[model samples]
Target: MFAALAWSLHAADAELRRALVPTSRYTPSELREGLCAALLARSSARRRRVVLEVTLIAGVNDELQHAHQLADFIAPIERACFDPRRKSGRTGVLINLIPYNPTYNRLAEGETVESRNDMSTLGIPHYSFFERPSWERIDAFQDALRARGVWVSVRASRGDADASACGQLATNRKLAAT
Candidate 1:
């Protein structure tokens, strides 16, 4: 069994992160530190693949600055996982960039507004609202990560019609709107 932490590391998008994951009290920095430690600990086992999953939203976590922050954050973890010193070293680290799985606007009863307000409580300009990112933007993000020598892949969206894929639920709603 592979050991992994599927964290939504929205580097600069802390508000969105907090909104999406309400269980965690850790800030973005704390999450990053904790994740790095976990990655190292998991890599020490030497029998599992260390995977870090980051959900990238169009205008939220897909910016160039966020990519740089991600690279810096994961560089050491990648090294720890891929080190060539130990007998069971070079286990490898895979970073999966999943685009945001959009959520439908449940505004029939003012729920959407309430949710928006909730997101705004974090002190940032509450802005989790996003659409699918452009192909160029995605490419730039991938390129930035790869430039840092990190193994990365843009996860393909699956089950869009049935809304099983990332962002498809919102996509479905958005489609209905248009």
Candidate 2:
């Protein structure tokens, strides 16, 4: 389960998400509530663990407040997984925090191309404001989640040297093709 903007159900949150990830067609409510419900159902039925990956973008959704919202959002799902009434042993949700990698466009000119039409052709947007959170910030965010009893882990970046990081794949493909 990938939820880069999990707290984006409210009007302001949704606007922030739209600015960063305009290509996303699903509403924030659908992405948050609907996806959580589906994941909970699947985990209960299959008796398996679910891992939710959230990409942390600096000044976008990496604040401590967002961490609290995330904890609140996943609380019910986590409880459902560990409900004593359910015979499932240890099925639960784990959150993986992935710091945003500097993509090709970000590294190239330090500015995003604002043309939506151009971005549509490449199937990727150039997020000028997106940046990886500092180590201190990441740690604080992790601590906040842990304080709320939510299991969480910080993911290390891989393939970043080759522009194949999490949000860089599509842009890399387009550049390679060109």
Highest-scoring model, lDDT: 1
lDDT of candidate 2 over 1-178, digit per residue (tens): 4332233232125455565556778755466566556655664434534566778877667889888887876665665456465453433667888888877354344533654223333333346545788999999999998888787888889998887887666454344455
Q: Which candidate has the highest TM-score of all?
A: 1
Residue ranges of candidate 2 with Cα displaced over 4 Å? 1-13, 36-48, 83-91, 106-113, 116-126, 170-178
Q: TM-score of model 2 relative to the true fold?
A: 0.67
Q: What clash count does candidate 2 reach?
A: 0
Error of 2 at 111 (Å): 9.2
For 31-132, candidate 1 gives per-residue lDDT tens digits of 666666765666354543566777776766788887888777766666556656546333466778876665544455545645555554553333445556
